[model samples]
Target: MQKRLANFDLDLALNVTESTLGILGGSGAGKSMLLRCLAGMESPSKGQIVLNGRVLFDAKSGINVPSRDRRIGFLVQNYALFPHMTVAKNIAFGLPKALSARQVRQRVEAQLAAVQLQGYGDRYPIQLSGGQQQRVALARALASEPELLLLDEPFSALDTHLRSQMEQEMVTRLRTFNGVSLFVTHNLEEAYRVCQDLLVLEQGHAVAYGAKYDIFERPGLLGVAQLTGCKNISAAAEIAAQTVLAGDWGLPLQVVDSIPDRLAYVGIRAHQIRFTEHANQCNTVPCWLVSTSETPHRMTVFLKFNTQPDHPQDYHVQAEVFKEKWEMLKQKPLPWFVQLDPLRLMLLEA
Candidate 1:
């Protein structure tokens, strides 16, 4: 699917199988726009969107399905519920118009029970809690037995505690839904917890899309690395088949396999840094302690390379450790040797 806007450009080409797939990107990166295109709420410049072997959108064919007839459940941010309608009426609204009054009531009851809101069906949206209102919205979406589900930051507006609860509830609720579900979220932890596959978008392009584990383990691009929470990235040049000189870290990193021929950058997660006393270890370097910050459960330690202080552009590397490790390290010294694991290192392209 592709769309061109005044400020953003979207170019995505991929197939989504039956599973919960995550669309991860920063704000205005075309996450919601793509969802709208899929829902037939927004037309793409030119592309085809097929669902369950049905052609939903084909520019060349001039076939565009209406949003109401697409049989897709779109759960947007803020729940998108009708404030004036009771929970039962809200859910019943999704029922097909052809259904009889008795059938609509039966279906609404079933949806309420499915979402564990049997007794709250008479309450209005204003009377319900944030989590309950979200459930009502979800129930309405699911009431029609949609062939596909599109969630656009469905839990983003909830409080931190409620958001976590809703995330778990959604996962459980969607387990029985045997269709494709696209979950758009910028929070990596939310995506990691709720999605089976990942689609990483950058500047409206599909930078990386694959199984969740594969995308996390081997993010091939620099943008993907940054999106995956890799705080330490350095310029690099391939010195040999299995080694590359990391210019920012001031070390030559050796990997288990041969490095890419045109490797342009290297990335390591902050938590991947290992403290060691031996300076002779492979890929170990002594760094001057810059500063440290303490959180409730972990510590963020900042360090700079032992290189001369003349290079102000050289950024400090952030290393994270649990409080227990911080306790042991704090008792010892200021200068420490940090080892970069060969297996954990990521060689990336620009």
Candidate 2:
């Protein structure tokens, strides 16, 4: 399907079974647009959508199923619960009206139990905590037993502590969901935690889509590397079958994997950089400390090569050191050696 946003164009062709796929991208990347199309809230400009052998949309065939008829569950970021409805009523809203009152009550009760909110059914949305409200949204989404489930940044509104809790809650629910699922998020860590497969969108394009580990570890595309939280990336030229010159960081990287021809970049996660006392390691480079920023558990150290201080812009590297290691490094002098592990080095095609 194709969607044209103000400044972005989204053209994606995706097919999956009963598995969870995380749609990851920054703002304006069309992640939510894709979900909306699948849910029948937005009609595609062209092409078709078939789910579980049912044609949800077929522009050429002049077929367009209504959102309610499509049986697709969508959990919005803000929970989207009705303030006037109790949790049971909200969940029952998704059930088909053909069901008898007793059947609707049973379905709502089962959904509430599935989300671990058995007795909270009569409680209004405002009476529940943030996490409870989120669970209610999940219960409502699953109440219809949808053929496809779409989650659009469902945890984006929660506090950090609550987000963690809801993430695990969603994980538990997904374990037995029995439907195709797609989760859209801009947060790479959350995507990694929830999805088995990942689809990376950039400016309306599917930059990369594959198993989560392959997509995260060997992102192949420069945009994918940046989106997957790679802090250190440098323009590079292939030096040999297993070597490349990192032009920006002023270092020659020797990777264990074979280097491809026409390589354009090299990427290393900040945490993959190891502190080294010896400067002669295979991928080691002598670096002088530039600055440091500390988080609760780790320190992000900015370093420049002792050899090319003049090219500071290009030679700057970021290395993540644990708080304990950072404290020890602070006791030392200005110069230190850092090693980029060959196994962790990513050779990219840009």
Worst 10 residues of 2 by lDDT: 306-315
TM-score for model 1? 0.95
- Residue pairs whose backbone atoms clash in candidate 2: none
Alpha-carbon TM-score of each model against the true structure? 0.95, 0.95
Please write out the lDDT profile of model 2 over residues 63-174, one tens digit for every residue: 9999999999999999899999999999989889899999999999998888788899889999999999999999899999998899999999999999999999899889
Clashing pairs in 1: none
**Candidate 2 off by > 4 Å:** 307-315
Cα lDDT of all candidates, in order? 0.88, 0.88
**What is the Å distance of residue 303 in model 1 from its true position?**
1.2
Model 1's lDDT to the true fold? 0.88
